[model samples]
Target: MDQTLSPGAAADYIAAQENKSLLRFLTCGSVDDGKSTLIGRLLYDTKLLFEDQLATLENDSRKHGTTGADLDFALLVDGLAAEREQGITIDVAYRFFATDTRKFIVADTPGHEQYTRNMATGASNSDLAVILVDARKGILTQTRRHSYIVSLLGIRHVVLAINKIDLVDFSQSVFEEIVAAYRSFAHDFGFETLVAIPLSARFGDNVIERSPHTPWYHGPVLLEHLEAVEVVRAAASRPFRLPVQWVNRPNLDFRGFSGTIASGVVRTGDPVVVASSGVTTRVKSIVTGDGERPEAEAGEAVTLTLADEVDASRGDVIAAAAARPDFSDQFAAHLIWMHEEPLLPGRSYLVKIGTRTVGASVTEIKHKVDVNSFQRLAAKTLALNEVGVVNFATLAPVAFDPFAAVPQTGSFIVIDRISNLTVGAGMIDFGLRRATNVHWQALEVTRQSRAAMKGQQPVVLWFTGLSGAGKSTIANIVEKKLHQLGRHTTMLDGDNVRHGLNKDLGFTSSDRVENIRRVAEVSRLFVDAGLIVLVSFISPFRAERAMARELLGPGEFVEIFVDTPLAVAESRDAKGLYKRARAGEIRNFTGIDSPYERPEAPEIVLEGGTTSPEALADEVVEYLQSRGYF
Candidate 1:
C-alpha cells in the first residue's frame, strides 16, 4: 500500500483514510513484559515511521538497546530521557498508524505498580486492550491488576498477546496453560471477546505476518484480527444525551445550546428535555461549524437551537424527552484513588462530572477490592492506586447515567479544593434512592425572618485550635458576654456534643472528619434558628474546616483560630489526655500523634498562649460590635 500517488489519487486516498473506522487500544502488562516493543513493532510493520525516525532509533539502540546487535524498537516509543535510561516506560506513549483497511490509535501504558494511575488513564478511552503476558512468567500480579482496571473501565475486547513465545520454544502447552489461568480469574470480567495470540515482538513473528516457528498454532495475525474486530459504538445505541457546555447567544433573535452529544442522536423537531429542570422543548435546528445539519449522533459536536427558549444552561443536560438520565445529589460509585494523600471518607472534594463541578464527599466506604484476588475487604480509607466502592453526596443534584450504560456522564474526577489537583477518578454505579426520596419541606418561617425577630444577624463563630488551647474557655466567655448584652447565643463544646451526638465515633482521622461534619451540620441548624452559635473544637484538618465554611452564607461563618504553641498546650493538659497520648495509651491524639492543620487565613487569630481568656473574649465581642452584631 504505497502512499505515493498522483494528485487525484492522493486526494482520493486522503478521503478514504478519513472514512476508515478508527480503533483505540492500549498495551499493558507487568514491567519487562514488552508493552513498548509490541507497539513499536506495530508501527514498524505498518511502515508509518520516517527515515529520520528509523536512523535515530538505530543510533539510540546502540546506546540503550537491550537486544544485542539489533534495533531496539522500544526506543521508538519510550521518548522520555528517564524512560530510555531506565529501560521502562514511565508515562503513557500514544502512537498513530494505519493499514489499508483501518486506522489505529495505540497507547503504550506503563506497567509498574506506582504508575497504575497512568495506565488507568490510558484505558479510560480505549475500546480494546492488548494485555501482553510473558510466556515464561505466565500470569503475574501486575498482569491481573491491569486486567482488572481494564474491566473496570468498560473495555470489552482483549487480545492476550503472549510475547516472547520464542523463549519458551513456542510451546503450545505453555500457551494453553496461561490462557486457562487467565480465563479462570477473568471469568467474571464480562469481556465480549478474548483472543490469545502467541508472538515475538522483537522478531516480528505473528504480529503482521504468519511465522513458521509456531507452525502448530493457527490464528489470525495480530494486525489482521485488529482490522477485522467489530467494536460497537455503545453511546450511539443508548438514549440521547447532550451535556450543555456553553449557552450560545450572539444576537437578540438567536440562542443555542452547544456541546458534544454524549449519546444517541438528535434531529430537527425532536422533543427534548432539560435533565435538571425537565423543561421540554423541540430541536429547531442543528448547527455545526461547517453548516446546518439535519441530524447528529454521539461524538459529534453541534449546537442545537430549541424550538422554545427554555432554561437550559451550562452544567445542564439536554436529552431525549422519552429517556432522560438520572438526576440526584447522591450516588454509589467505584473510585480509584490516585494521590499520595490517602482518600479520607467524609473529607470534602470537588467532583467534576459531565460539564458540571460540585462540592462532594465520600459519605461511606463500602469496601475495597483486592486487585489480585478480587476480594472485597473492609477499608476506612483508600491508599494510592487502591479501588474502593463508596457513596458520594454532592451539594446539588447532577444528571448522569450508570457508567456501564453511558460513560461520558457516569465517570468523574475528584479534585482537591485548595490545590485544585485531580486526586481520584470514579465511575457512578446508580443514583441512591434516598437522594430522590428526601425533599426540603418548605416553611413559612425562614432564617431571615427569625434573625429579624431577634434584631441581630445569625452567624456561626467557629473556634479551632490544639487540644487544651483554651478554645472552650474563650468561647464560653464570648457567649456569656453576648448573652449579657441581650444578644441570643449558644455554645456547642466538642466533648459535650460527642457525649450525645457523636458518641460512637472514635479519634481516628476518618472519625475526626465525621465528627466535625456532624458538628458543622448542627451549627448550620443553630444559625437557622437566629442564634450566634459558638463551636469550640479541635478541628484539625483544614479540608473539613473549609467544608464547614462553604455550608454557610457569605459573612455568616467566622473562623477564629486560637493560636497556642504545642508545648504550651501540652503543659496545660488538665485532662491528662496528653499524658496518655505520649505514653502510647491513646492513639490519634491531635498535637501528639495526629496532625492539626493551622488555619491559613482565619478571620481572627488570638494568641491563647500569651493572652488571657477574658482579653480574648473582649477582643471577639469588640469585633462583633464593630460589625453591628448587637
Candidate 2:
C-alpha cells in the first residue's frame, strides 16, 4: 500500500512495516455519531482495501447506505446482517491497517446505549479513544456515559472527534462550544492528553490530510496526531508480579510456574514470594517455548522454575520478595453492571481475577454514579449500564495490586454461578484495612468437638416457598419432632426473626436478600454451637440460597422446597396477606407482585397443598435420618 516503494522493494516494505510500533485505539460515541464511518474513512485513506473488497463495499453501499450516491464506508465495518438491516453497530468491530510510520489496530464500537457494554469491552484493551460527537447534537448523555467509562477503564489519551462538521458549515464557534462543554464535564477524568479535531467522515475533510475548508483550524490532522502520540509504558517499572496461571509439570522432574508477567522484570535467582502463603523461593530458571531466557519483562509469557520446593499453585501471585501485592478477603471497588438482571448486594457471584475464581458477594452498594452530573446517588441495586462503588467479600483471600498501579492483577469480572454469564466488571481500589487487622482467633473447642459432646450431628434445615405455602408450619413441626427425639435443636422462623434480628428490614428484593443473608449467618453460628438449626424463610432468589448453602460444610445445609401452587396458596390465604397483595395494598409481595424462584435441586420437595404438615415433617425427619444426620 506504500506509494513510495516500488514492486522490487516489496520485501523491504514488509520488513519496515513489521518493525512499526502498533497502537490500539477505538472509536466510540452516541448513536448516529459516525464512529463506523470514521473508521471506514481511515481504512480507505490508508489504501488498505483490495479491489474485491472495495467492489463489495460499493455494492453493499447501494443497498444499505444512508448517504445517497456516496460510498457507504460503514458497510466495510458493519458486517453483521442485523447491523446492516438496523443501520446501527450492535457489536465491536476491529480492523487493522498501517501508515508509513505506525501500524494500528482500531476498534469501531457500538454507539447505542444498550450496547454500552460492548464499548466498555473495547475500551478495556485500548490505550487511546477517539470519541466522536455529532456537531449538531453537542455533548449528549451517551457521550458522557462513554467518556466516564473511558476514564474508569484507565485510558489516558482521548481525541474528541467532532464529526459532520460540514453539516454545520465548519463553524469554529460550534467546535469551540462543543469542546468547552465536553471539557467542563470531563475536567475530573484525569486524562493526560485531550485533543480536539473537526472532520466530516462522509467526505474527506481533515481525515488523513488537512482540509482547506477549515482555514481557521490549525492543528495536526487525525492520522498525524495518532502516529505522534506517545503511549506510556509504565508496567515494567512497577513491582514484579506474575499471577500463576498453571503449575506446569510436564514430567515428574520439571516443575515450573507458567504465566505472563503482569508487571516488572524477573530474572534468574531473583527472590519471589507466594503472595497468599508468604512462602519465599528463588527463580532458578526462566523457560520459554523458544528456550531459556535470562530475564523477561511485563507482557512476556514464560515459565519460571523455583530453586526451593515451595508451595505455589494457580491463583497465587509470585512477586518480588521486598514488594508483595496485598491479599485480603474484603475490598472496595467500582463496578460496571453489564447484564439486564440488576446487581443485588447479598446474592452470590463468581469473581474471576486473573486465573483464580472465588465465590464473592457485594457486601454493600455505597452509591451509583449519575454519569450526567457525576453525582453519587444512593442506590440499593445497579441496573444495566449503571456504575457503582461497592464493597466485595470473597470466600477466600486473593492477592491483587490496586488497579491504578497494576491493572492486569487488579481487575475482575463477575460471573453468574448458575448461568456462567458475565454480569459485571470491576476494578480494585484497595483492600479493606479491617479485613487485614481482624484475625480469626484459634479456639480449642471446635464444631466437631461440640457436636461430639452433644452426641449428634449439627445441621441446618432451610425452608423456602411462597408466603402462604406452609413453609413455617412444616419447619415448626420438624423442629418439634427433632426436639421430642432428644436432639438439641433451635428454630429461627422468618416472622420471629423479623421482630428481633431483622426488625429494620422490609420485603423489598434487596431487603429479602439481606434478610436471608443474616438468617444464614445465624444458622451457621447455631450449627457451630452443636444444635440442629431450622431456618424458615421464603428465600426467593436461588443466588441467595446458594450463598447460604456455600457458607456451611458439605451436607450441613439442607434446602426444603414447600411446593405449593400459587393459585392454591392464594386460595387458602391463611394469613389474608395474599388478599392485600392482590388488592395492590402490599408491594413486592411474593407470588403476587414479585417473583419467587423455585429451587432447581432442593434436598426435599414437600407437597404443601396435598400433604399434611405432620406428614411433611415426618418425611423430612426420615430423610435426615437416612442421611445419618442423627
Candidate 3:
C-alpha cells in the first residue's frame, strides 16, 4: 500500500534509512562550551520538533525547571534527571536530524579526559566532526584532544563552530585568530577540510538560519553547510564485494546468501566468486526489501541468490569474479589499543574482521603512528589508546583489502578472552601468505599417548613473582611433590624458557611480553596432555596473567604469586641480576629498573625466602586439591 508519510514521519524515516547519505558527525567541547545548547537550538530553529514534543518540554519546564527559562534548552536532548540537574552529558548520545539537503547522525561526545574512551566510541566511525570551541576560551586542551581523536578516527571533515559569539561581541579578529591557531595545529593530521562558522547556538545567530547581527560573516549558516556539504562517500565504481553475514534459507531446497553490499555493485547474472574457496558462480537474482533489483549498489542490504548451492556460509565474502581478495594466514595492520590494558607482542586474540573471526598474534610492531602528526615512530608496542602500525599473523587464512581501498573488509577488532572486552581495532595493510617451504609441522600425539607418557594430568601451575624472588625454587619443589603424587608434571622455569622456546625473545618490553606468551601456550599444551605444567616466571604484567588464566578453563592455570617486598627482592641478590640492573647493565628489566604491576589477587601468596620451597610446593597441591583440580 502506497501511503504519504507526514513531514515528521518522513524526516524520521529518512534519517533512519541505511541507504540515505548519513553524515556521521561528533560534537566535542568541555563543560560550559555551549555544545548542548548549540544542538538544542539547531533542533528548535529547524522546525524538526512536533507539537507533542514541544508540549512535553513546556510541562517539564513548569514542573522542575527552577529557573524556568523555557525548558533549559539543553534538557531537550540531555533528558536524564541527573543530567538535567547537573547540566552535563555523562555519556555519548546518538541523535539524528535532517534538513532539505542532507541527513545527519550526530554523536555528542563527552569532554572529560577520563571519558576519552567514550569520546572515541562516538568518533570512531564518524565521517565529520562539529568541534564546539567556546569563543572566550578559544581552543583549550580538551579541544585539541578531541581534535586529535577525530583525526585519528579518520574523520576527514571538520566544522569548527566558534560558539558563544555573544560573549565576544561578535569580534571578527578573535574568531580569525582562533581559526588560524586551530588550522595551524590541526593541519598536521589528515583533516581534509575545516569550515569555521561564527555563531551563538543559544542566541540562534547562525545555527538553523542566518542572522543579520553577523553581517561580516558571508558563509552560510550551520544548517546551510550541513545541508550542502557532502558526507565523503566511497564510490560504487569498484569491484562488487559482499561479506556473507547469514544464510537465508526459508526452506531446505531454496537457499540464498544475505548481506549488505560493502562495496561495488552486483547485477543479475553477474559473475561472482566465493573468497575462501575461490569458486566462481553467477548471481541468479538480487532480493531486497523493495523486491528484486536488476543491480544492487554499494551500501544496499540485500539477499543474493546464487547460481549454485556451493559451500558458502558466514565469513565468506562474495565479490565480482574477475577480482580476488588478498588471501593469507597472516597479515600486517595498524592497531589501536582500545582497552585499559597494554598491548604486547606474541599475545593471541580472536581477531574479528567483518564477519570472520580467527586466532591471531602480533608477530612484530613495525612502528607506532603519532595520531597528531601521523609520524611512524619505531616502537616495540602500543599502549592503551595509542595508535600504532603493527603486524599481525593469524592462524587461519582470511580475506582482506587494504583499509585505503575497502573500509569494511579492511577493519577488525581484537577480543580479550579474559575480560571479554574489545581490546583493539585494526586496519589491514599487508597480507603474508603461509610458507609452503617453511615445513612447520605441529605434533600429532593423542591426548592418551601424551598423558600416559607423563603419568599424570597435565595442568599449568603459573607462578608469578618479582625478580630475585624464589619462584623457581618453589616451582621446582612443587614439581617434585606432584611427581611424588604420581602426577606427571614439568617445571617450566622462567630462565629455562628464555634459553629454549623463548630463546629469540629478549627483556625488551615487547619481547618480555612475547616471552610469557610462549610459555603460557606451551603450558596450555601440557594441560591438554594431562600433565601438570608448572610455570615459574616473573610475568610482572597483571593483564597478561589474566589472559593466561582465561585461556585455561576454571581453576586450570593456577597463579601463585611469590609475594615479596621490592626491598626484600633487591636484598636477596641470589643471582646478582638486581645488582646488574642497578648498574645499568639491563634495560626494561622488571623490579630493578622497570615497574612491576603486582597481581591484586592470586590463588596462593607464598612468601619468598621466608617459606620453605617444599612447604610452598605442598601448599600449591593442597590448594589445587581443594579446588578439585587433583
Candidate 4:
C-alpha cells in the first residue's frame, strides 16, 4: 500500500472500502497498565503511522521516553501535553485504523478513578472492550471496576489482555490463574464472550505479530483475533423504532420524518404509530441523503414519508403499530452519577434519550452498587462515580424499551436544568408497574364526602424554615389546639419521622429533598382521610416544595414559611446542632454549611423569633377558621 495519496483519491478509496465491517473497541485498565502502549503498538505494527509522524515520534520518544534508548510506544496515543508530561492518559482519545479484514475505531480511555466517567463514555459506544491487566498485578480493583462498567453498558464481548508478560516471565500458569479468578467472580455477569490473552505490549509480543516469547500460548495475536471476531448485528427482527430527530420540510410538497433507526427495520408501507400520540400511519417511502431506498435497518439514518398526514414531529417516536414500545412518565433505572454535585432527589432535570428531551426528577434512589464488591448498599443520594438503582418521573410520558432489549432507546442522560451540564447517565430497567398497569380506582365515598362527615375541609399546613427555628414547636401547639377543638389532625414532625420512615437518609441536600418528598406524600394521604396534616420540616429547596404542592389537589396544600433569622436559630440551638454545625462537626447542615433557600411567597409568614409558639399556633388556628376549615 502507498504511504501517501492525493486528497480526493484518498477520500474515494476510503468511501469505497465500506464493504469491510467496522469494529468499535476500547482499551481500559488501571493506571500504569500500558493501555496506551498496547494501542500505540497496534497502530505501529499495522503500518498506519506516516513517515513524518514516525520521525517526530522517534525524536519525541528520546526526549520524553520513560525507558532509556527505547521508543516509548505510549507516545503514539497520548497526544495531550498534560498526558505526555504526566505519562498517563487523562481523556478518552479515539483513533481510526484498519487491517486487511476490518476497519477499527479504537478508544484509549483513562484509567484513573476520577476519570471513570470518561471511560464509561467511551464504553457506551464500543462494541468490544479490551480490558488490560498487568501480569505482575493481576485483577486489581480498577480492573474489576472497568469490567463492571463495560458489562453495565451492555458490551458482551470482552478481551482480558494480560499485558507486561515479560515482567511475569510469560508463565502460562500465572495467566491461567488470573483468568480462572476472573471467571469465578464474573460467573453471573452474563458476558457472551470472554477471551484471555497473555502478551507483552511493550516489546510488541503477540500484539500485531506472533512472538516466540510466548511459545506456550497458541491463541491468535490481538489483531488476528480482532479481525476474525464476528460482529453482532442489531436486532432487525424486532419491532421497528425510529425516534424522529428532524421533520424534513424542505419543500411544501415533501414531508418526512428523519432519524436513525434505533432498532428493527422500516420498509415502505410498514404500519407505524407515533409513540407519544398513538397516531397510526403507513410509511410511504424511505429516503436517504443519496435517494429513496426500499428499506432501512437499525443504525441507518434515513427519512420516511408517511402515507397520510399525521401528528409526527421531532421528539416523537415512530414504531411498529402492533408492537409499540412502552411509553411512561415513570421508570426504574440504573444511574451513574457523573457530576461533582451529588444527585438530589426531587430536583428537576432534563432527561434526554434518543431525540426526546423532557423535564425529569430522581423520585427515589433504591440503592447504590459498590462496583468493586457488587454489593447493594442503601443510599439516599448518589455521589460522583457512584452507581445506583433509582426511580425517575418525567413531566410527560416518553417512549423507551428496557435497556436489555434496545440499547439506543433505553439509555438516557440527565442534564442539570440550571447548568445544562450532563450530570448522570441512566439505563432504563423497566417502567414502573403502577405507572403503566394500575388505573385509578374510583370510590363511592370520596375525599369530599370524608371532609363533609368531619364537618371541615381537609388541608396540609407545610411549615419550612431553618433548623431550630421553632417550626416543630409551633406545629406541636397547633396540633394540640386542633385536637382540643375536635378537629381531625396529625402532625408529621421531620425529626420524629426520620427515626423510622427516613432512617436511611442523612442530612445532605439530596437526602433532605427525599425527606420532604416522603413527608408530603404521607401528608397527602392524611388529608385524604379528612385530617388537617401539619408537616414541619427544614425543606430548604424551593423546587422540591413546589413539587409537593403540585402533588396535591387544588387548595389542599398551604405553604407557611417560618421566617426566623439564622443568628436567632443558632442562639437558640436546642440540640446543640447549631454549635456543632458551626464547629464543622456536621456537614450539609442548613444555615451553616449548606444553603437555605427562602420561599419567595407563602400563604403566611410568622416570625418565630418574635412570637411565642402558642401565639403562632393561635394565628394558624384563626387562619384555618377563616378558610371555613373549623
Candidate 5:
C-alpha cells in the first residue's frame, strides 16, 4: 500500500496540524552579534525552507558571504535588497516555522541604535525574547538594553543565548562567568523563566540538537527549552472586556455590537454594561461567523445583541456587569518616542487605543531612561528612540485596564495631527484616580446664566506676537474700551503673570508651552464667569494657540496676530530684550534664538509698528460686535 495520502487529505492534514499551540519570540542583540544568523540556522535545521529558497541562498552566499565557500545563513533572514548588500538587518523581519511539539514565530529585529523603535515593535506582541550575546564579548550594553525593553513589554520568559562559543573553544568557565554577570544585573527584572544556553549558531550546535562541545552542560538543547517553556495565554481567564469596533445594523430591525473578545468569556443572557456610558443591559444573543453561538471566549470575534438598545457605538466597551474597568481622562504611562522631532509637552496628538481615538497631550515628563546605563535622567523632552515616564491628559474619558492586567486596552499610539504619522507609542502603567475624583461640580448658575445676567457674551481675545510687537499696548486699549462700555473685563498681561503665576518658567521651549497653558486655563475660568479676558502673550508656537482655542467654546476665543517685522521690533527694543538676546544674555528669546510662528489665519491682524493701538483696539471691538458678542 502507498504511504502518501491524496491531495485533499493532505490539505486537511496540514490544516489540522496548524492548530498546535504557537510560540512567538524575538531575537535582539548588538550589531554583528549574529541574530539573523541564529534565526536562519534554526529554520534550516528544522527543515522549514524549500529547495528553491536553499538554492538561491547558496548562490547569494557565494557572492556576499564573508566566509568563503561557507553558507551564509544570515542571508536567509535578511530579506531586503539593502539589507543583503549591507549584510545587516534594517527592519524587523518575521519568520514562521513549526516543530512537532509547537509552532513558532520568530522576529529578527535590527541591532542598530537608530532601529530601537523597530525592536520595540517586534517585542510588543512577542511572548518571549532571545537576547543573543557573542561569547567573545559577553554581556555588552546591547544585551542589557534588549533585556530592559523585553521586561518593559511584560515578557515573562527570556533565553540568554551566548552564541559564537566555538571562538572561545567552548570554555565552561567563560560561559559560567557570563551567566553570573547577566544574572546579577537582571535579577531585579522578576522574570518567571530565564534560561542560559552556550552554543555556536554558525555551526548549528545546541540549536536544534544538543551539542557535544558543551560537555559540562546538562540542560536541554535550545529547541527543547523553547518547546517546554510555558507562557501565559493572553487575557483568557480575566474579566470580560470587548471594545466595540463596529455597530452592525444591516437593517432597521437588527442591531449588534461587533468586536473580538479581549478577555474572559461571554454567553447568551449574560449581564453586560457599556464601559464608557455605564448603561446596563443583558446580552440577548451571541452571533459568530458560523452563526449564533451559546458562548464566546477570549480572542473570538462575535457580534453581541443587547436585550435593550443603549447609546453604545464604536469605541465603547462591553464588559461583564459585575466586573468593569476603570475610566479616566488622565494616566501615567511609559512613552517610547519614535519620531525625529522631540516631543513638545503641550502639543496635542491623537491617541489611539483599541477602537477609540482622543486628543491627548503629555503634560509632564517625569524622567527618561538612559538605555546604556539603565539610569533615570531628568529630561524636558524626549528625542528619537528615547523612553520616558510621562503624565498624559486626554480630552475625553477612556476605559482601560493596567497593562499588567490587560495589554489590549492599555497600549496606545500617539499620532501627529498635521503629519498623520505615529510619533510615539505608550503603555499605560495605571490610571490616575485624581482624573475621576476631580469632577466638575454642577451649579445652577452656569456660564450661560452668568452671561445672561451680565447682558453680554463671554469672550477671550488672545493677542500673540513677537517680544516688542505692541500686543500689550493693543490689549490695554481694548480692555479700557470694554471698561468704558460698562462690560466686565480683565487683562492677563504676560509679564505680570510671569512675575507670579509663571515665575518658575523660563525662556526655554518647554517652559514657554507651560506658560501658555497656565494663561489659557486662567482665561477659561474668566470666560466661565462671563467676563471678557484679554490674554496678551508672545505665545510663539501655533500649536499652543490652537490648544487655547480648543479650550474655549466655539467663537469665544479670538486670535489676534500682532504683525511686526523683526527689524522693527529689534530697532524699538522697548525693554532691551531683543538686544540682550542678540548679545547672548537671553537664550531662547523669540525673534532671536527661538522661533515666532506667525498665525496662518487670525481673527484680527494689526501692523503693530505702524498701526495705532487705539485703531487696532477699535478693529477688535468691531469684530466682537459683528460676531454678536454684545
Candidate 6:
C-alpha cells in the first residue's frame, strides 16, 4: 500500500504507478474568478505549504507588494516573479508535488480568453482538468471557452470547481442549476467524466477536508474523487511508448538513447527499432540515475544502450517496431492558431512531434470550429485563437499515433523560426481521409540539354516584389524580347502559375514559401535542361529565397529585386490587394497583416514602379548579352 499520500497525489499516483496515472491538472479562471483563492485555500487547509513558505506568505502579506492577505494562491501557481505581480499565469506553469500514495504534476493555466493558446498548452498533456467557475456567476463564457479547449486536448476527466460558494449563499439549488446548464453545454464535447462540486476556495470547503456546512449534500469530496479515480494507470496500460529525447554517450565507446519512458516497460534483450531509420537492435542495458535496472517501465527516465550500433539520433523514436506508429503524408488534426498571422496553404512549417521534427505544411483547411455554436465552419482559413481541422503534409515520413490513442506522440507544435515563438499546437486524426494523391511528372526536357539547345548558358532569373509591383510586367516583356531574339526562355508568372501549378495554395506566409519552393524546383530543372528560366513572384522571405539560391550556381541564378517601397507600391495599386489590406479585410497579408522582408544584396535591383516596363526588360537582356548570351 502506498503510505504517504495526499488525496490529490494518491489518485493520480496509483494510476501512474501501475503505468496508470502520469499527469496532473489545474485550471485558472479570470482574476476575478477566484483562481488564486481556491488553490491557496487547498494548500493552506491541507498543510502542503512548508513552514518557511507559510511564514514568507504571512510576512509578504503584511508588507504587501500587490496581492493581499490570507494567502493569494495565484502566487503559488505563478512560478515566475514577473507573473506573480502581474496577477496572471502567462502560459503553462507545471508544478510537482507528492504524497506517500502518489506523485503528481500539475498544469496551471491562464484564464483570459485571449490566452486560449496558453490554455491549450496547459491541458495538452493533462489526463484530467479542474475548471474554476465562480459560484456567484455560476459559469461565464470563459468557462465554456476553456472546456472546449480541454476537450480538444483529449483530457478525459473534468471537475467543475464551483468556487466561492460563500458568495452564492451556499444555495444547493443554484449549484444544481449551474450543473444542469454545464451538463447541457458539455454534452457537445463528449468528455468522459464531469463532476461539479460546491465549495469556497477561500474557506477550503470540499477541496481537501469535508465540510459540515453541506450536511444536506452527500457525495465524496473533491479530494476523495481525485484519489479514487483511475486514469494514469489506464493511459500506461495502452501500449509501450518511449519518445527518444537525446542520444546518451558519457564515453566514446558508450552509446545509448535516453528519454523519459512515455508508456510501457522495457527489459534488457528487448528488441527495439528506431522509427525514423527502422534499424532494429536488442537492448543491452538500462541505466537510470537511481542505478542500473533490469527493467524500466513507463514514466522512468532511463538511458538504454543497444547491442548493435545504429544511426539513432535526436528526433528519432524507439519502439517495439511491431506496433508501428500511424503514418501518412496527410491527415486531419485540430489546431490552436497562436500567432497573429493567419494560416494559409503552401506554407512550410517545422513540425515538432514527440522527439522528431520535420518540415510540414497545411495542405488544406477543412473547417473552423465555431466557438459559440460548436459547429464546424467549412472555411479555407483560420485566424488567431481559432480552432480548426487542417490537413498537414510532411516533406519526409513521420511516425505518429492519433491524438486520441497517444496524446504525447500524436501532439505537435509549429514554431516560427523568425519569431522563435510556438505559433501553433495540433493533434492528428489519422482517419482524416482526404484526396491528396496527385502525381507530379517532370517535363521531359532536362536542363543540361536545354542549355546546349539554347546555345547560351541557361539560368534562373528570379524577380521579387510586392504583389502589384512591376514583376509580372517586366517578366512578360523580358520573355517576349528573348523570344524575338531567338534565345530559349520560359517565364513562370505568379498569376499564370496560380491557375494550375499552385492553384491549391492560398495567401499565407507558409504557403508562399512552399509556393516559392515548388517554383524554384521547376526553375532548377529548366536551368539544368539548358533553357533560361524567368520567374516573377513576390517571394517574401529571405530565408526561403536563399534556399532557391542554394539549388543553382552563381551564373545559373540571378536575383532581381523589384525595389518598390511599400508606399510607392500601394500608390500603384495595380490590384485591389493594397486597398483591401488597408481596409483590414484580411490578416497576415504581406506588407500588412504580415511583414515582408526585402531582399538584402540581391543580384540586381530594378526600380519596379519608376522604370518603364520595356526598359526593365532591356536591362535584363543587356545583362544576358554581357554574359555572351547575345
* Residue 574's lDDT in candidate 2: 76
User: Who is ahead in lDDT, 2 or 4?
Assistant: 2
Point out the higher-scoring one by TM-score: 1 or 2.
Answer: 2
lDDT of each: 0.94, 0.93, 0.79, 0.89, 0.89, 0.77
For candidate 6, the per-residue lDDT at 297 reads 83
lDDT string for model 5 (1-630, tens) is: 889999999999798777778999999988888999999899999998999999998998998876589889999989899888888889999999988889999999988777888998999989999989899998887778778878888898999999999999999999999999999888878799999999888898899888988889888788998899989796788889999999999999999999999899899999999999889999999999999999999999999999998998899899989998878899999898999978989787889988989888998899999876778999999999888999999999999888888888888889987668989988899998765556678798999999988889999999999888889998999988888888889899999998999999898788888899889999999999998999999999887888888898888999999998888878888898887888999889998888888898898998888878899899998988888898
**What is candidate 1's local distance difference test score?**
0.94
Give me the displacement of residue 193 in model 3, in angstroms: 4.1
Q: Which parts of model 5 have CA positions greater than 4 angstroms off?
A: 1-8, 62-65, 81-87, 343-347, 363-383, 435-437, 480-487, 563-568, 598-601, 604-619
Give the worst 10-residue stretch by lDDT in candidate 5. 433-442
The parts of candidate 1 lying over 4 Å away from their true place are 1-5
Q: Tens digits of per-residue lDDT for model 1 on 433-484?
A: 9755567899899998999999899999999999999999999999999989
Model 2 C-alpha RMSD vs. true structure (Å) is 2.1
Candidate with maximal TM-score: 2
Show where candidate 3 strays beyond 4 Å: 1-23, 29-31, 51-71, 188-193, 249-251, 288-293, 363-384, 432-490, 495-512, 521-534, 538-630
RMSD of each: 2.0, 2.1, 6.5, 5.6, 2.9, 6.0
Give lDDT tens digits, candidate 2, residues 91-141.
999999988899899999999999999999999989999999999999999
Candidate 4 per-residue lDDT, tens place, 1-630, comes to 868989998888877688789999999989999999999898888899999989988998998888778878899989989999999999999999987789999999999888889999999999999999999998988888888889889988888899998898889989999999889877777788888889888898889888888888888889988998886866676679999999999999999999999899988999999998889989999999889988999889999999999887899999999998999999999998999988988787889989999988988889998877899999978898889999999978899999988888999999986567999999999998775556779888888889889888999999999998999999989999999999888888888999999999888777787788788778888888888899999889876787788778888888999899988998999899988887899998998889988998898899988988899889999999998887
Error of 2 at 214 (Å): 0.4
Query: What TM value does model 3 have?
Result: 0.74
lDDT by residue for model 6 (1-630), tens: 858889889888656676634447776555567665566655676668998988777775555434445665656666666666566667677766554455567777778776778878778667788888887886777787788888888877988888877787788988888889889888978778888888877767888877787776677777777766677554465556678889987888888889987766788888888777778888899999988889988778899998899887777778875675665567779988888877756556678988877767787888888776778788766788888888888766777888888777888998764455788999887744454465666878665556766688888889998877788888989999999989888889988899999999777666677789899889987777778889998888875677677678877789999887788888888678879888998666778877778887787889876778899889988998888754
lDDT of 5: 0.89
The best candidate by lDDT is 1
Error of 4 at 484 (Å): 23
Give all TM-scores, in the order shown: 0.96, 0.97, 0.74, 0.79, 0.91, 0.80
lDDT of 3 by residue, 154-255 (tens): 678889999988899999998899999899888776777789999987778988778787889998888888777776577487678899999999998778
